[model samples]
Target: MGTSLNIDLTAPGARQLPKRTHVQYAALCFRIREGKVKVLLITSRGRQRWTLPKGWPMAGLSPARAAAREAWEEAGVRGEVLETCVGGFTYTKRTSPHPHMALVYQLEVVSQEKKFPERGERKQRWVSPKRAAELVEHPQLARLLREFHPHLRKH
Candidate 1:
């Protein structure tokens, strides 16, 4: 319980830094098209790796809500955040120089932005989930997309 109390804030080495699991909200952003599930993937700004919309936790917002906000900023789409998330995955956060555990949620996209933030810096595309799985670099995230059912939501 007191492990965190021993962490040194100014530690430069990752080994010296407390082993903490950073959190992020990832939108497994998708849409229904002609009775099929179409997943939206965006190109990462630096390496241009195909990936989902994700961001650090926002103030006063839940994980799913932050996922929605990230969708708007990164993919230029607005969506509905479902209470149920597919699962979580991990990736090394470039900015932080450490791995982050990302909670992935399904978002039903409803609208797109014409001139939103990060425009022209990244490319967004809509493709079949299987195709998206093949395109994305994250293994766990790819598996999640490949296994996600189009009819997941129950009404």
Candidate 2:
């Protein structure tokens, strides 16, 4: 038999490739104010790239509830989440521990916290959906935001 080579994934020095696609909740946090539609975006923890608020499924909450929780944790948003998911988009994976598939939920933010979870690690922004589409790196998410304008209902 030929000599075999092996590397330990659990080793501290070994680099880990992204695992299989993970199903996660994405908060399509948005609001209508002053006759305009605004979407919220938050920066990633380490790389600081702009992204939507999202996380793994919470213990007992429904998907939309979990998405709302993510919004509050990542963006300090408190709001009503529409049960019907507007759309979903595959996460464009980069160098990550786990590649993810995100189900996007629309949230109508009613209040925002001045101090909340992840405040120090992230920065939140409210901008026009068009502007959000321009800033986000994920292609499907960007397109979702771009085409979102027509769905706006006067609030």
Candidate 3:
């Protein structure tokens, strides 16, 4: 988590203020097994809310690259970034003081490692799409899970 302060740099008495840019990057990894679709979700260490493994994009890394790193760090999964993006959803930042938008990407899990190095304090779970929708705190993520259900069933 990070913090940013909102400073209004007005010349004198400006009626309208310029909008500040706040960008956040995130990724979602979905794994399908058998007839059920399972997504790797991590419970936040502080809030204890279940969410997709995501974070700010790292320097010199593309969104997809950052996503793969995040998935490995948070969920102990090694996945492939499909040529096509499954979908994306936006949500306001609840953890940050500043009002920021979080961009979520859908990634497919190709493989998984046995251990997670960074998220020792947090709990990771592979949940069914239906169960995921109910467990995630964000409605948009829940909708994403729903959208993935039909496609996952086919695989």
Candidate 4:
């Protein structure tokens, strides 16, 4: 996803902030149980920090499809991916100086496999959306999780 900035050039010493040079697509995997939203969060491979399943764009997949693929690969999540992006956030990894923006799509999870690509490499858990927000480090992503609501129309 592309973002546009509205800068005021007339302001004294005004300058444009650097755009996010790296982009990733992510899946906010969730399911409703007992009338409550349960979110699935996975730990990062290197940092062990909780986060959504995300990755760089794939050559031929659409953004939502790529996000779905990441969810499956990273967390064994198989679901219905909504093309409507819930939100996006920018952050810089501890290992790199470049800022990365992640476009997030909501995935209403159908099932989770017993084994998947990253199953042994990372930890996964199911928590409330608020708890999911608390477990993640990025404030913007946290906010997105906190504010997330299921689509009223059935899938």
Candidate 5:
């Protein structure tokens, strides 16, 4: 004897999705001056949108390390990246159907070079957190920038 069972997926009930989501790591690089925190923002290559330094995970590199590398590559930033994730945000890419979740790590910037890998391709800026919040396109990222507070000794 054999038995078979079937269920309607679109019967107006909760259903589980089998979709795959991509993950990227990002660096929220910042420097403190006069007790105010300023964050670095870079222009995206395609749309030229203001955004943080972020990229896909690299082979043989940890998430935080990959984010630090992205910071260096995108904005000429050499900094200390906190291993703990500050927060995450999701966005859909133009070429892919899967949404990408970006995990953000706080990086205390040490130095920014006059020339970097993406210098000719993008514009960079350092602005107060509130200003940065206003500049970025993503709402969640803007909120993260708005609520950011790093507890570190003043330099």
Candidate 6:
């Protein structure tokens, strides 16, 4: 009998493969008043970087629905999710346990509570649209803020 070497083809680096990814939904909630457009941003609990309210999607609900829920939970604001998506951008999840692609949405802030339960954990701010663009760390999100500037101005 001849000795033979058996290779495991499914090994991690056995083949060049596409990176695995999951989809995460996020909400960019804006409050426009007196010709001034302000965007709600949250300081992440983990990274402490200023970013829009977002999280993983939920079962039995649409992406927009998940965005709405995240907005409420993170910012203590309730909003109406527009039928149209203002924009979307992809971001690599370097810190998340699993790799993810975030689908961002625009939500109109209809109402808000005086206090948020997670206020201690997260810092929320309503900043000018232009300032928001500068504040958020994500370039893609900043672009979206600029894209929505016209609509935000009118409202």
Give one digit per residue, the lDDT tens place, for model 5 in 36-154.
Answer: 88999999888999999999999999888999999999999998887778877778778898878788888899999978888788899999989999999899999888888864534
Runs off by more than 4 Å, candidate 2: 1-19, 92-98, 149-155
| Model 3: per-residue Cα lDDT at residue 61 | 80
What's the true lDDT of residue 46 in model 4?
A: 89
Best by TM-score: 4
Candidate 5 stretches with Cα past 4 Å from truth are 1-18, 153-155
lDDT of the candidates, in the order given: 0.79, 0.80, 0.65, 0.86, 0.84, 0.73
Instruction: Compose the digit string of candidate 2's lDDT tens values, residues 1-155.
Output: 11112435599979654667687888888888898988999999878888899988989899889999999988899988866666666765566666677887788898998898788999889999899999998898898888774334356
Best candidate according to lDDT: 4
Which residue runs does candidate 1 get wrong by more than 4 Å?
A: 1-18, 150-155
Candidate 4 collision pairs = none
Model 5 has an lDDT value of: 0.84
What is the TM-score of each predicted model, taking all chains together? 0.82, 0.80, 0.72, 0.85, 0.84, 0.77
**Residue 37 accuracy (lDDT) in model 6:** 75
Candidate 5: pairs in clash: none
lDDT per residue, candidate 4, 1-155, as tens digits? 22223336478899644764688899989999999999999999988999999999999999989999999999998989887777888888877788788988888899999888888998999999899999999999898888888663374
Which 10-residue window in model 1 sums to the lowest lDDT? 1-10
The predictions' CA RMSDs to the true structure, in order, are 8.0, 12.1, 8.5, 4.9, 10.7, 12.7
User: What's model 1's overall lDDT?
Assistant: 0.79
lDDT of 6 at 46: 80
Instruction: Between candidates 4 and 5, name the one with more favorable TM-score.
Output: 4
For model 1, how does the per-residue alpha-carbon lDDT over 1-155 read when each residue is reduced to its tens digit?
00011224477763442377687888888788898889999998988999998988999988789999989998889867775556767888577776687788788888888788988989999999899999988898888888876434444
| Regions more than 4 Å wrong, model 3 | 1-18, 83-85, 89-95, 149-155
